[model samples]
Target: MSTRPAAGRCLVDLSAQDRLRSRAPERAPMLRVLCCPPAGAAAGYWRFLVREDVHVLGAQYPGRESRFREPAAPTVEALAAEAAAAVAAAPWARAAITPGASADVPLVVLGHSMGASVAAELASRLEHREGIRVALLALSAKTAPGTAEVASTGAGTGAGSDEDLREGLDPLAPGADAAMVRWLRRLGGTPEAVLEHPELLALQLPALRADLRVSMAYDRFPAPVGAPLLLLRGTEDVTVDPGGLEAWRPVSTGPVQRREYPGGHHPLADHGDRLLEDLLACAASGRSG
Candidate 1:
């Protein structure tokens, strides 16, 4: 893989009604958060979460963000492993190295949607394989592994062929057509230019296909995880089935807690503020749950 410079900050002009935005604190922070985006999505999508005393670091997977110039990983396990490596090597390595952070502020993992599983797997890899200690894990939208009762991990709503992958993803992308763009607008997956650019489309689809494959063929972790796990879901979430949530019971080694929102599939976005409060509350109240 080739090395590329970090994405240079660029300014985008948007209407107040059309633009998505978040506020970051202007001073030093106590805790730093490592955030991972959902599948078919890029890093920095969670820019809205930066706030007072909180520094949010969004993990950029290969094939997206500055890593877009590099080759995408072929499997979820590979991707998860790669992300774990990056976290171990980050500039703040001293803050949350193996065995947990040295400071009082806890090292937290907040993964939304597909990110929930990705985050869980990352924590598992770090602790079980790499010997890193994760203070707490906040998993949103996705159920615990083996818990998604209404949905199966393998074979998504989209067909398996690369061509089908392109077609299924095109709608979630930005520029297919007014109708397709509208569809993507609702999904909130990619940027308008990416959906319109063929070059970027070429870069994104293979990675997207690989992630879907990971989702489908993914097997549960060999054993239950030891970290405190908090599961969040939406009452109206189409992708998260109740049976799926129930399935998570057997896979977690620590105490398991569930929080359900009143919205659809994307519960975090629908209940971002409430979700953030609950996550912080959960992390601050205890050591091991």
Candidate 2:
């Protein structure tokens, strides 16, 4: 998928201090958010989601950005396990839940499209293995994990043609393939420069292929997630149809929240403001912690 921030928001570099924590830098985040980016994405792909009490920690999949030299994860479970460690080390991780008492803060995970699978797997680890209570699990633009096939309405659905991923392409090629770029454009969310620029495109391809491979093959951990669930879908999104959004019903044991927008596959690009609004609501009300 092609990605760029919509005009409503600006990209925030995690390496630098973020305005999201400017108001309450000293206070441990009342809610810690781990947002997994979709295929062909890296950690910093999340646009700034501002809230004084909330902080979004971008999930860093290997083979991209600072992790460029690291090997890409082999399965959705691998990505989840890596992210689980990061969440367990959050500043409030220890402070939130006491020996027998309830948590003081919420641990929230959000993912869109293929990343949604990663988010679900990560939530399972936190709730079942780490014993960390997940306050919320937000999934957007994807069918429920374990569904056999993708929605027929989506463009280029299923695992995708192997050629579309451009695996093992010339590292020094002058540019990316035009037809592949066009296909990606149809998928939505990728930036134009990334689609057209050779060097940037090359850096994104390997991770994209790996992510898609696992994401397409992934199924839920067979344990129902205990976190409150939030399913966000755009009415116009071809990637996930209405029936697909409804498929998340039996995936969770806690309360479930479903919301619809008037956009497409990339909610952050056009509807990030509303998405944050829903997240804020979920954080306050879904406090199983």
Per-model tally of clashing residue pairs: 10, 5
With candidate 1 superimposed using the best TM-score fit, by how many Å does residue 172's alpha carbon deviate from the native?
Answer: 17
Candidate 1 accuracy as lDDT: 0.57
lDDT of 1 by residue, 1-289 (tens): 7443232211111111123344332544554566767776665666566556665666666766556566656665666677776666555555555344355456667777666667777777767776566666777666545433343222222222223334454445554334333444444446679877867766666566556556655656535556667777678665556656555565457676778888765556556567667766666554644
- Write out the backbone clash pairs for model 1: 147-244, 147-247, 148-244, 149-243, 149-244, 153-216, 154-216, 174-195, 237-264, 237-265
Models 1 onward score TM values of 0.71, 0.81
Q: What is each predicted model's overall lDDT from 0 to 1?
A: 0.57, 0.67
Best-fitting candidate, scored by lDDT = 2
In candidate 1, which residue ranges exceed 4 Å CA deviation? 1-30, 97-102, 143-206
